[model samples]
Target: MDNNRLATKPHYQILDGLRGVAAIIVVFFHLAEPLASNHLDNIVNHGYLAVDFFFLLSGYVIGYAYDDRWHTFTVAGFLRRRFERLQPLVVLGMTLGAIGFYFTDSTIWPLIHTVPLWKLLVVLLIGYTVLPVPLSMDIRGWQEMHPLNSVAWSLFFEYIANILYAIGIRKLSTKALACFVVLAAAVLLHFAVTNANGDVTGGWTLNFEHMRVGITRTIFPFFAGLLLCRVTKPVYIKHAFLWCSLLVAVVLFMPRIGGATHLWANGLYESFCIIIVFPLIVYIGAGGVVHSKTESKICTFFGKLSYPLYITHYVLVYFYVAWISNHNGITLKQAWPYALLTLAGTIVLAYASLKLFDEPVRAWLRKKLK
Candidate 1:
């Protein structure tokens, strides 16, 4: 057994830079959609697919970090680490949002009448691991929700992957095959059911149709990362060819292959994207492509602060929108300034928070836990 292979530290900085890029793309996607209507030309709106990138990255990093420890990893230790990594900022964000809601004229009435205290507590208890529906009907009123608990949908799957890993589920090759088969079958079943119901148009549903669909959609991508982690390849020739093939697969699927005939096609395409992209990133990181002194400093700083950036960027976006909306209506042409300002502000705030809040608290908790 190669102890060094098992003892790999996992590249942090490059992955963090990639994560920053993904977050920025998602924010751009959201901002672009509203601004698109103002533009006379059609534009590509695949920014939401950045979420898939994040999922792929999560799978790779989690597998790299925890796979070696799976046999002896305790649930308590695993959860404690997860909580230490995630909870502090989440609690802070939710509390700040609540306070902002309370102070702003945005109606404590809505928070009282629409958002039930019990439900909010349930959401917080879930530890931002579940994606709440964007809208829900309650007895008090019709509630429009934006997942104050956002960034969690992917975390839900991360937990799923972690649990599976802990149970040694990935150790059984046959079982892994069966699991993939089942996931594929479930995805096909969903598409068939939805097509039959003629619910092709995207909309909200009581059973959380979209979320269920999303889970199936992402399974293959997640597994692709897992498979990459467990396998080793010749970096020079074979790996490059494999990466190229996966990239080609993504390109083929980029065009919307219309109708029920292409239902599973989209998932397959996304899987290919993950298959190629994740390894390419890993290879680049491992091969010292990004380990230059200058690159290392930049990547390490951004990566260390990436999580805070993800959590706080939305607040920056909200203020950006407010500023743009107030100072003459924002047009597509006007989006560049707002986007740049918001991006810069997000980076600055994220860096400051990581330094002043996250790092110090994390250091203290590490000492206590030790």
Candidate 2:
């Protein structure tokens, strides 16, 4: 085998930057989440949409990275790559949550200290696999798949997408994939337009409804991204990163539409963005090249920072939210300083996690497994 062909390829640098940008927005979303009186009013209201954005990016990048390598690859090997890439951070995020759990005791989760250590450890270890724990494992009272780290729900869906791609979906003809993507898109539109909330802002809690939301949110972008990679050639779009970043920010940061009365308004808006807008952004991002050294460095840094930030940032938010609940009626003005600290802390922790933990561990795994 030609070793170079089997080796990993260079990333689409701009997409990496886009991923980082979306990840950062997700953090802001979570921080703002506790502040929202309800899901409708959260200033970073559409921040949850970034998860779907991440799926699009993942689909594009995975298609770019692996579609042509199957001759030399196996399903097991592909899964190994994904596990090494994702699971380490899963463990770290869970650990951080466990470490901070008791200390964050407040009205938000007043029973935090009451949970037995054994149950917490059980959830933590199961979380290492990124599997969704059942309601019986609801140590934190939120009933999330991984209460220690709620974001793992997305990662669980991410693994499903990857497995689907590896086992069968990636084998389909381009025409077939397109048909698949269209069906998936219909699922997404139906859910987004008519769901009870009028927005596609959930999937964290494991339930039939959330599962439908989760599966719908995941498949369309991912398969559409794969189809995009297969059918289109990336074209040069000047200022691609800037344009894409702005589009993402505007979409995610916009206020909920039609208020409580016009849920379909918000639903249709979100559907339009995810179905049409996000894929367009990815296509543009993939096409653009970095022209300046400074911009190149910025993209590289954000690319490295994105996953770790997304995976681990919520550990601190658990406490931030608890602090808010403890202090009744805390406004953003009063909480801004602490919120800044939470943001800064997550950034620092993500950097540390990337360099100090994730990279080294993945390197060692590759060496051993290979």
Among the numbered candidates, top lDDT falls to: 2
lDDT digits (tens) for residues 1-370 of candidate 1: 2221235475755556666655655566545544554322214234445555665566667667776675554655665666667656665554444434322222223444456667756544443433344344221122322244244445555555555555555565845745774575456345534453222222212246655545554555555556556664424433332343344234322443323454444444434444555456555543333536776676666567767877666655555544554545567676787777777777787777788887788767756764
Off by over 4 Å in 1: 1-12, 38-44, 102-146, 174-206, 234-272, 275-288, 322-329
Q: Tens-digit lDDT track for model 2 on 85-185?
A: 99889989999988988788787675687899998999889998888898888888887889998898999999999999999999999999999999899
State TM-scores per candidate: 0.70, 0.98
Assess each prediction's global lDDT (C-alpha) against the native.
0.52, 0.90
Query: lDDT (0-100) at residue 222 of candidate 2?
Result: 90
